[model samples]
Target: MKSVNQIAVAVAVVGISVSSGFVAAQTKAPAVKSSTATQAKSSTMLKATMADVLKASQASDWRSLNPENTLYLEMDKGRVVIELAPEFAPKNVANIKALVKEGYFDGLAMIRSHDNYVAQWGDASEKREFKTAAKKVEGEFTIKYQKDTEFTRLPDADGYAPQVGHANSFAAARDPKTQTTWLTHCYGAIGVARGNETDSGNGSSLYAVTGHAPRNLDRNITVVGRVMYGIELLSSLPRGTGALGFYEKAEERTPIKTVRLAADVPEAERSKLEVFRTNTTSFKALVEAQRNRGGDWYKFAANHIELCNVPIPVRVVK
Candidate 1:
């Protein structure tokens, strides 16, 4: 009789052979029966893979991006789609929306592209003017943690905050002791650039994170939103040569054709996309699948996932 360890090895070997079609001589082993039967009868049933979880998700598991809260940054190459987080930075988002409607960023330039850091754009000139009245929004680095907030906590350790989770589809951190919650500086996170004063950022200068999660920036800067799609457009730009990745020569700055709110654009011109709702049962299953990769290719599961490693799925509305 084979030991338990030996049985597991035999099962793994059989699974690989069956998946790789090494037993083609067995009349192409029944596709469904061979795979499902073996796994189901095993003492330890394999967890569903990420692909399997996503495939089993229902239509209700996803939510459409609200056009009123979406922004499109148009450049020569393509448009970068951004989703605003009103729940976190309401005043900043409101000011940004007003600026977009007033055509404040119609001809501004992207003045900075730092390699593995950030891609920032705004009025680089000192004589820049706002077309509309820009409000002085106080720095909204963190908000009062409300119990009713829709937060889906993750079962993982984070070096930055005591507890990490997803709030309104945005990566976030919460401290129950202080009763405060703040957005994390995950990749693609958009923050308003400020000067010496905390309230200096008036929805004019904005930067998107292109590198790893700089969690230290949380609670230090006002993060307004995140780039939902077309991050490649900004990430692929040439890094500037001057200090802090600013373009040394004025001509090197990339021209921004326009920045418009999706709601302001014509219906046919708007981009249609949907994001997976993080508060759904399917999302929990998806998270579990990622924590422990269970597939024929994986010999051992890590049984762990980081806050930044979690991928929020987005798909075009067909």
Candidate 2:
């Protein structure tokens, strides 16, 4: 089994290498230093690594995760902290929270760990009764694009959506032509798994992206949130052997200890975490640094970054 640190490095490499649309299809341009870009004008960003950008960030550049909007998936390995984006999928978030309160996922098992895809967890028998959560929920694949939406759009081009950006700290995109906005299937995204019918996903069966950015699923499924911490715990699980990566035997499955709302957990037991806000100058600088990685190792800069390639950083607070 890989340690949490190893899994993070491996997953990050997968995210950067395999995510579609991360690199442009056009012919490779001549290598240019990152200093040539307009956004690189800031000395802090000019030829500076992402670490430098983060190190120079101010306290105002980060936002704390709300206890009510956080979920902790406890397992034998460790806890996976998820930051729910109720702003994008309010109904689903509400239902999931209700299910958590009812202890719906207390003793369930992770049924699937699809290689280069997702790690899913829920009642495999499909016989569990819902105490409060609805069995079906209308998909919130896309919402009406509001002018006041908190989005930090990437200037690069994307083949999947008209405009790719980050909204409410989640990777998202919007189409002004249709006035619609939806979350993308980025690495670490938590989504509801449904059957043939769109409304079948009721937050009972949830999955987190463990591999590359499955951008093809965007708007086709409901992405409720992202892993704010401990994604490695899910991504490092052994790949399932059955179809769609479902474990064939009960013994092969990893048991889920419990799923609890951070608000419900004791204050001392909760994670002291804060996420780097997307709508900040420091984050923008970080994006630029990623677009054109600094240091002496590279001869050229990519000069382009996709929605999933740009990482959303989280830090533990003292």
Q: Return the lDDT, model 2, position 272.
A: 80
Model 1 misplaced stretches (Cα beyond 4 Å) = 1-45
- With a 3 Å backbone cut-off (N, CA, C), the pairs that clash in candidate 2 are none
For candidate 2, what is the lDDT? 0.83
- Model 2, 80-147: lDDT tens digits are 89989888899999999999999999999999999989999999999999988899999999888678
lDDT of 1 by residue, 1-318 (tens): 224333222222112111223334766534454564554443222777656775677889878788999999999998888999998998898888988888888889989999988999988884666666475778999888778888999998888898998977788888899888888888888998988788888888899988877888999999988887778778778999999999888899889999999988999998776667888888888778767665544444567888877767665664
**What is the clash count of model 1?**
0
